[model samples]
Target: MTSRPLSILDVRSAGPAGRALCVEETAVFQHPLLEDPPASAASAEDRRRYAILQRRAEQTCLACPLLAGCLYDAVVRHDVAGYVGGTTARERARIRTLLGITVEPENLDTLAGVIGGNRPVDHDEVVRLRAAHPDESLERLAHRLGCSLSTVKRHLRRDRNGGRTREQEPRSRPSVRAVLATARTVLDPARGSRRAA
Candidate 1:
C-alpha cells in the first residue's frame, strides 16, 4: 500500500478560506509565553504582556476579511506554533478543552502525511474496562491502561469520544479479517493512483 503526501498548505491552497492570514504576516509578533523566560516568576508582567499582544492580534484579526476562516482552521486543526485567528497556542488549547474537541498530535507532523484515523487505545478495550469498573476514577482508569490521564479522558470523553457506541460494543475489538480489509483499502502507487476525481 502507498500514500500520497498532502500538505496542509496544499489542501488549504485548493480552497481560498484563509489566504489573508498567512504565517509570514504573524511571524514578527512574539507570544508572551514564548517571550517571557521566567513566566511563573513574572506572572503579573506576563499576563499584562499577553493581554496586550492578544488584544492587538485579535484586533487585527477582527479587521481581516479572512478572520472566520483563519480562526476556524487554526483552532480546529490545533495549529498553535504561533498566533493565528488572534489566539495563542495556549488559548487554542483552552478553546479545544471547552469545546470537547480532540485534535490528534500526530496530525501536526505534515511530513508524516495523512493518517486516516488512528487511536492510541482500542475502543473495545476501553469499553471492557469501563464496564468492569464503573466505580473507577479517570486517574485509576489511566493508571490501569498505562496511559496518561489525558489519554484516558480523551478515550472516555464525549460518550467514549473515539471509542465504540453501544451498537458497536459487541464487536469492539476488530476482527483480523476486518483489519486486513482496512489495510487493503490504502491506495497503492503501483496501481496508478486510485484516487477518484
Candidate 2:
C-alpha cells in the first residue's frame, strides 16, 4: 500500500527520456555553484564565479528530459540538497509556500526500506502489528513491520478509509506541469531582481 518515494529509479522507469542528465553529469551537479550561493559578504569575484556556474547548471538542467519530473519530485516529495531541476533549495521552498504545500521529512529508518532491496510490506501485516500493539507509536509500528513510516501511514489510512487508495480519495492538488510552470516563475530573472531590490 505504500508507494516508494520518488527516486532515480522512478525517473529511469520512464525509459530513455527519463535518464536524467544529472545522473550522467554527476560532477557538474555537485559543483559548489549548484549549491547555495556564496554568502552575502562574499567577495565580488566569488559571486561572479557562482553566477557563471549557476548558468552552466541551469543550462544542463534545461537540456534534461527529466526536468519536469525532477522538479516536481524535488518540490513536492523530497527536500533535496544542492541544485536540482534548475532551482535551488530556497527556490523550492518558495514554490512550496506559494502553492501552499508541505513535504514531510522522510524518516531515516525508512531509507533502507526505500532502496534496501527488502520485500514490500503487506497491508495485513501493518494492520496486525497495529492490533497487537495498540498503544505503540507509529514509528514503533513501522519498526515492527519492517517497513517505512510512510508505508505504515498509507496502510493505516487506507484501512481507515474502507480500503480506498490515495488516488481514489478526492483531493485538490496542482499538477506536475503547474508546479513546473510555477518553478519558472520562481526562477525568473526579473522577479528575482525585483525581490533583491
The lDDT per prediction is 0.45, 0.65
TM-score of decoy 1: 0.37
lDDT of 1 at 60: 61
**How much lDDT does candidate 2 score?**
0.65
lDDT for each residue of candidate 2 in 101-173, tens digit (9 for 90 to 100): 7665344445565626656677888888888997666767877776665577667756886876533211456
RMSD in Å for all candidates: 17.4, 12.8
Q: Write the per-residue lDDT of candidate 1 for residues 1-197, one digit (tens) a residue.
A: 22423221112211334556444445434442432223454569766766566556655654565644555555554333445654455555565544445455322212333222333555457667878997665557767765544445444553544533323112233333332222222212332234321
Model 1 poorest ten-residue lDDT run: 5-14
Estimate the TM-score of every prediction: 0.37, 0.53
